[model samples]
Target: MKNLKLLKWILILAALGLFAILAARAYLAHRAAPLGPWHTHVPNELTAAELARSDWTGYLEVESAIFTELEMAVTRQLDPADRVPANRYFDGSPLYPGRFAQDWNRSFVLDPDGPPVGAVVLLHGLTDSPYSLRNIARRYREHGYVAVAIRLPGHGTVPGGLTVVDWEDWTAATQLAVREARRRAGPGTPLHLVGYSQGGALAMKYALDAIDDPDLPQAERIVLISPMIGITAFARFAGLLGLPAIFPAFANAAWIGVLPEFNPFKYNSFPVNAARQSSLLSRLLQRRLARAAQDGRLDALPPILTFQSIVDFTVSTRAIVDSLYARLPANGSELVLFDLNRSVKFGPLLHFGGDLDPARLLPAAPRAYRTTLVTNAEADRREVVARVIPAGETTERIDRLGLQYPSTVFSLSHVALPFPSNDPLYGLEPDEAEDFGIRLGALSLRGERGALIVGADMLIRMSSNPFFPYLLDRIEEGIDSSASGRSGIDRDRL
Candidate 1:
C-alpha cells in the first residue's frame, strides 16, 4: 500500500509538471503577434512518390504552380500592417525577391562553355534557398562541371509551407535534382554531391541509398558544409511544443521564432515543424550510417570532403567528428576544420568551450580520414596556417596560408563556410556589382539593448568567412581530381 501511494504521487507530480509547461507555452503563444497568411497558408506540394516519378521539367512546373498559389493566397492578401518596407512577402517591398533582375531564390542550372567534364548537384540548408550555394555553383560551371542547384520544397516559397513538409519530401526532391544532373552531364561521368547544413544530411542519406539501390547514381565524391548530423534536445521534442497549435486559439505555437521577413532569399521566421523535420532527418541518417558501418557497406562509401567551423550555434560540431567522420573507411575522406582565432588580440574576451581544442574535437592521429586545422600559427599573432594530418599518419604537415583572422571576427559560423568574402549579400565587404536590397553581412548596428529587432547574439555572429579563397581552391582541386577519375584527396598535398 505504501509503494502504491508513492507511485500515485510520482504520477501526479509528472502530470502537474507537464501541465505547467503547456500553460507556459500557451501564454507565450498568446503574447506573440498575430500570425500572417504567410504563417498559415499551405501550398499543394507534390508527394514523395509523385516527386520520384516526376522529371526535372515536371518538378519545376509543380514548383511554379506552388509559387503561383503563394502569390495568390499570401502576397495578394497581406494586411496593411504587413505591407511594411522590410517585408519580403510584400510584393511592392524592396526586399521582395521578385524585384531582382534574376532571383537566385529559385532553382538554377549553370552550364559550361561546351560539353561539361562532370556534374555537381548542390543542396542548400533548411529555410535557405538556392542563393546560398549560387557562388559555388558558378565556380563548378567554370570548372567545366554542370551545376544543378535545386530549391528544396517547403523552401524558396514561404515559411508556412515548412509547417507541413516532411524530410522525405526533401529527399525526393534531391532525387529529382540528381536525375537532372545525370541527364545533363551524361552517364558514367564523375558525379559530385555538395550539401550545406540540413542539405548535408540529405546528401549523406542519398549517397547511402545509392549504395543499396542500384537505380540511384552513386556520387564520385561527397562534400558537406557545416553539416547537421546532430541536433539539440529542443529540436528532439519540437513537435510536442506544437501540440497547442491544434487549437485555433493558440496558432502561434507552431512557430518558435517569428521575425520580420527582410532577407530576400532566406526566411527570417522559423517554424517548430522545420526543426522537427531536421531532427527526424538527422536521426534517420545516423541510423543508416551506423547500419552501413556494421554491414561493411562503408567500404563502398565514396570519399567525403567536409568544411566545418570550430564554433557553430546551429549544428553539432562533435557529431560531425564522431558520428559521421569516425565511422568512415580508409577511403581517403578529408575534414577541413576552421579553428577558433586563438590570436591574443581578443585577450580574455573570447569565451568559447574548452573542447574546441583539436585534441578534444577530433580523434587521435592516424585517423581513417585526413584532418586539417586552420588556426593561428602563434598564440599571440593573427597569422594563420594549415596544420594537415594525413590519413593513417601521426605527423602533421604545416603549410603557411598567408591568411589572418579579421580583427572583427573571432571564429567562423555555421552559415559562413560555403560563402566567400566577396559574396554580394553575405560578404563582410560585399562587392558593389550586385544589390540584394540589404547587406546583411556588413550590417554593424550599435545601440541600446533591446533596441534592435533581432537578438544581440545574431548581430555579433560572423556572417562571411575571410578564409573563403582557400576553401574554393580546395574545392577546385577536388573537381580537378574527380575529372581525372582520381576519387580521393592527394595525401601528399596540403
Candidate 2:
C-alpha cells in the first residue's frame, strides 16, 4: 500500500509538471504574438507611457471650448485658403490649403532611424478628429512603420451651428497629412494612405489629384474602412447635392436630420453645411467617374482597397458599388465587400442565429453565406455588390445622375464588421455596444491595394486584442499578389 501511494503521488507530480510547462509555453507564445483583437504582444523590449488612466476631467472644460470655437470657425469660414476666417463667411475659397503647417500637441510613435518599412497617413471621418485614430496609429507603430493620424477641421468640437465645410477643405487636410507623413518618412519610404468613411473618400480624391505631381511620393497602398463614398438617393434632393454649390446660403434641407441608425455614434443631428460639403464631394467624385467613363482615364486612378457593409444605413452601398467601385479601372482596383448579416458564426464555440441573440446578449451570428465579390466583366461596367435582406423588406433601387447605374446588389448590414466587444477586456461588465477601434487597427495593418472591405463588427473587436500576425499575413499576401501584377483579387479569402 505504501509503494502504491508513492507511485500515485509521483504520477500526480509529473502531470502537474507537464501542465506548468505547457502553460508557460502558451503564455510566452501569446506574448510573442502580434498585438491585435484576440491577443496583445506586450513588447517587453519597448517601453512607453502606459495609458491606464481614464480620467479626462482636467481638460473637459477646455476641450469643450476648443470644440465650440473650432466648429464656429468651420461654420463661419467660407474661404477655402483661410483657416478659421477672421470674419464670418460660409462661401469662401473654392480650394482650401492644408492645415498641417499649424502646430498642436498630439502623441506620435516613430522609428526614427529605420529605412521605414512604409508610411501610412490616416484621415478621420467628419465630425471626428485625428484622435479617433489613436489606437490605429499605435498598431502601425508595432509593425515598424511610421503612421500619422490627422485631425480634420470642423471635427472634435461642439456641433458648429452651421455646416458649411466644402470638399476642398477636407481634401486639403488629407493632402497636409500625407505630405507630413512623406516628409517624416524621408525619400525612399513608400507612402500608404488609410482612411475611415469620409476620410476614405478624401484619400481617393487625393490619390487622383496626385497623379500628375512630379514630386509626389510613390504610393504603396490605400485602405478604406466602412468608407462613406456614396449617399442615398434622398440625399441627392436634400442638402447633400441639391443646393450647396449653387447657393451657399440656401438652407432648406429637412433630410439632414439625424436618424436613429446614427445613435450608435451618439450623434443626434447632422450639420447642414456639412451635408452641403458632402454634396460637393459627391458631385466631384461623380464628375471624376464621368470623365473616366467618357475620356478613358479610369485606368489612371490609383490601386485601391475599400471595405463596405451592405447593411450600413449611413451611406448608400449602391452608390459605392455603382459609382465608385464599378468605375475603377478594370486593371488597377478591386473591391472587398462583406456580408454583414452573415458575419458572426461559431463565436467562441457558440453558434447563434438571427440578427440579435438574446442568450448571447450580442447580435446573432452572421448567417453562413458565401461572398459574391467579382470585378472583371466584358461589359463597359463592372460591379461587385452583395445584399442580405431579412424577410418583408423591399429592395431599394439606385439612381445615379437621373439615370440608373448597372450594379450587383445584395443584403448586409452597416455594423457587420467584427468590432471588439466594448467590454471584451472586462470580465463580465462589457459595454453594451462594441468598439471598432481594434478591428480598424487590424484592418489598417492588414490591408493592401486593390480594395479591402470588412463588416463593422470585425473592426471593433480588434482594437484591444491586437492580433498582429494574422493581419501581417493578409498584408503579405496582398503585397505578394500586387508584385506579381495580379488584377481582380479573388474574394474567397476576405
Candidate 3:
C-alpha cells in the first residue's frame, strides 16, 4: 500500500512538471510570435537628484505602464470586431499660438533641455506608434540629437481609423516632423530621419517627395531599418484568401512571423480593415514608382542608408531590392542585404494551403538566380513573356550591373527573410559574436563622407544572433583593415 501511494505521488509530480513545461512553451511562443512586420527601442529621464532617489524598479514600473498602454491600444485596434473604437493616445493637432500648447510642450520632454547637436525624426512601423521608436530615440538623445518620435495620424488608436488615413497623410506627417526637426535644430544643424519597418518606406517616400521642396530644411541623411516598401507573400496570401474584408471583423487566422525578443505583448492577427489599408498603401506605392519614373523624380532622390536582413520573415527582400533600384538615386544610396542560412530555423510551425503538412514542403534548396522565361498567347490574343528569377546574387548583381539581365528576381517569402528570434540556429552569447550592432553602426557612421546607416540592426540581428563566427571575424577584420588604408573585401560585399 505504501509503495503504491509513493508511485501515485511520483506520477502526479511528473504530470505537474509536464504541464509546467507546456505552459512555459506557450508563453514563449506567444511573446516571441511575430505580428507580421511589427517591430521597435529608448532614454534616461531621471535628473541627478532623481537618479539618486529612485531605484531601477521604479523606472521599470513606469516603463511598464507606458508599454502596457501602448499594447492595449494596439491590441484593441487589432480586434476589429470590437464594438467600440480605441481612444487616440496622441494629439497631432497643429500647436495653436496659445499658452496651453506652450505648457504642454514644456513638460513633454522627459528631461530638462539638453543641448542638441542636431535633430532626429523617427518614424514607427504601420499599426505601431512612437512607442516602437522610443528606444532608438533615447539613444539619439544620448548622442546629442533632439530625438522626435512622431505619432502618425489615425495610429495609436483604432485600426479602423487607420483605413481613413491614406498614404499621402502618412507622407505629410513625416514631412511635418521633418519640418519641425529642422526648425527646432536652428541654423546649419543637420536633420536626420530614422524609420523602422513600414516607417522606413515612408521615410524613403518623404525623401523622394521633398527632394525639391524649397521650404524644407536640408535633410542631413536618412536611416532605414528593416524598411517595408514591398509586399510579402503572406500579404499576397491574405489577398489570395479573398481579402480580409470578406471575413468577420473578429476573425484572426494564425500567421507565422519574426518576433523581436524585446517585444513584451502578444499581437492580434485580425483587423481586416488594417489589412485592406495595407493593401491599398502597397498599391499606392506601386503607383508612386510608376509616377516617379514618368516624372523623372528618381534621379533627384536624396541620399539614403538602408538596412535589411536576409532572414527577416515580415518584409521580403524583393521590396528592398526594388526600392533600391527604382527609388534610390544612383550615387548616394547604400544597401545592405544580410544573408541567412537555411540551417537556422525557428519553431512553432504554421502551414498554409490548408492542412498541407510543412515537413512535406521540404525546405527548398538555395538557388542562385535560376531563371525561366515562358512566352504564351492568351485567349485575349495578348502575347507576353514572363521571366521568373529566384532570389540570388546574379539577379541582385544585375541591377548594379544594369538592366541587361531579367527584370524579376524570384520572390523570397516575406517571413522567410527576417527569421524570428526563436529560430533554432540563432545563438546569443558572450563570444566573438558579441557586438555586431555596435560594429555595424560604427562602420555605417564611419563610412566615407558620413553615409547614412539604414536599419543596420536588421542585418546585425539576423547575422550576429545566430553566432556566425566567420561573419563576426570578417566584421572585426574589416574594421581593422579600414582603420588602415587597406580595403576589405567583406566590407565591400556588406
Candidate 4:
C-alpha cells in the first residue's frame, strides 16, 4: 500500500515538471516577434528525387521558377503595413538583391578566359546565397580553373524556403554542381570541392560518398571553411520545440527567429526546420566518417584543407579536431585554426573564459595532418604569426604573416573566413570602389543596448577576415600547383 502511494506521487511530480517546461516554451513563443510575409511563404523548390534526375540546366530552370513564385506570392503580395525598407521582401527596398549589378544569389558558372586547367565547385552555408563564396570562385577563375557556385534549394529566395528543405535536397544539388564543374573543365581536369559552414559538411559528405560510388566524380582536393562536423545538442531536438505549432494559436512556435530581413543576399530570419535539417546532416556525416574509418575506406578519401575559428559558437572546434581530422590519413590535408586574440590590452576586459588557452583546443604536436595556428606572436602585442606543426613532426615552424588583429575584435567568427578585409559587403574596411547598399562589417556602433533594431551580437561579430591575404595565398598554393598533385606541406585534413 505504501509503495503504491509513492508511485502515484512520482507520477504527479513528473506531470508538473512537464507542464512547467511546456508553459515556458509557449510563453517564449508568444512573445517572439511577429512573422513577415517572407517567413510565411514557402517556395516550391524541387525535391531530392526530382533533383537527382535533373542536370545543371534543369536545376536552373527549377530555380528560376521558384524565384518567380516568390515574386508573385511573397514580394508582390506583401501587405501595406509590411512594406519597410528593412524587410527584403519589400519590392522597393534598396537592399533588394536584384538591384545589384550582379545577383550573386543565383547559381553561376565562371569560366576562365582560356580552356580551364582544372575545376572547382563552391557551396555556401545554410540560409546563405552563393555570395558567401564569390571571392573564392573569382580567385579560382583567375587561376585558370572553372568555378561553379550553386544556390542550394530552399536558399537565396526567402527565409521560408528553409522551412521545407531537407538535407538530401542539398546533397542532390551538390551532385549537380559537381557534374557541371566536371563537364565544363572536361573529364581529365582535376576537381576540387570547397564549402563554407553547412557547405563544409556537404563537401566532406560528397568526398566520402565518392569513396564507395564508382560513377560519381572523385574530388582531388577538398577545402572547408568553418565546417559543421559537430554542433550543439539543441539541434538534435529542435523539431520537438516546434511541436506546439500544431495548434493554431501557437503557429509562430514553428520559427526560432523572425527578425527583419535586411541583408541583400542572406536571410536574417531563421526557422526551426532549418536547424533540424542541419542537425540531421551533421549526424549523418559523423556516422559516415566513423564507418569509413572502421572499414579502411578512409584511404580512398582525398586531401582536404579546413579553416576554422578555435572558439566558434556555431560549431564544435573540438569536433573538427576529433571527429574529422582525427580520422584523416597522412594525406596532404591541413587545418588552419584561427585562435582568439590574446592581446594583453584586451585580457582584463575580455570574458573568453578558458578559450584563451589555445593549447587545450588542439592536441600535442606531431599530428597526422598539418596543424597551423594563426595567433598573436606574443600575448602582449597585436602582431600575428603562423605556428605550423607538420604531420608526424614535433618541432614548430613559425612564419611572420605581417598581420595584426584589430584591438576591438576578440576572435574570428564562423562567417568571417571566406571574405577579405576590403570586401564591399562584409569587410571591416569596406572598399571605396564598391558598396552593397551597406558595409555591415565596417560598422562600429556604440550606444546603450536594445536601442537598435538588430541585436548587439549581429553588429559586433567580425564579418570579414583581416588575414584574408594569408588565406588567399594558402589557397593559391594549391591552385598554382599541378592540378593532379597535392601540396608539399601535406597534413591531410577536412
Pick the TM-score winner: 1
Q: After superposition, how far is residue 3 of candidate 4 from its true place, in Å?
A: 12
Worst 10 residues of 4 by lDDT: 485-494
Error of 2 at 447 (Å): 41
Task: Residues 1-494, candidate 1: write the lDDT tens digits.
Answer: 99999999999999899788888888899888998888888888888889989999998888889888888998999999899878888998988887899888788899999998889999999999999998789889998899999999889888998999989999999999999999998876888999999999999999999888878888888989999998787899898888888888888998989888888888889999999999999999999999999998888778899999988889998999889999999897999999988888775877765557778788889899999999999999899999999999999999999998988788899998877887888898999899888888888877888887778786667878899889888888889888667644321210
By lDDT, rank the candidates, best first: 1, 4, 2, 3
Alpha-carbon lDDT, every model: 0.88, 0.44, 0.42, 0.86
Model 2 weakest lDDT span, ten residues long: 37-46
Residue-pair clashes per candidate, as listed? 0, 55, 18, 5
Which ranges of candidate 1 are over 4 A from the true structure?
A: 1-8, 487-494
Candidate no. 3 TM-score: 0.46
Q: Please estimate how well model 2 matches the true structure, expressed as its whole-model Cα lDDT.
A: 0.44
lDDT of 3 by residue, 1-494 (tens): 99999999999998898667545544544554333212211111333244334433443344345345544554334433322211122221121111121221111122116666667788877666554454456555655567766655445433333433455656666666665565565655556677877787777666655655545554556666667777564454343332222333312222222222221111222343445445566656667766786777666554455555444566655655554544443433445443222211211232233112212221232332122222122222222222233433234122111111111211122222222222222212223332211222112222443243223334333222221222223223322322232221111111
| Model 3 lDDT, residue 196, Cα | 75
Candidate 4 residue spans exceeding 4 A from truth: 1-19, 351-356, 484-494
**Can you list the residue pairs that collide in candidate 4?**
333-491, 333-492, 333-493, 369-491, 370-491
Lowest lDDT 10-mer window, candidate 3? Answer: 401-410
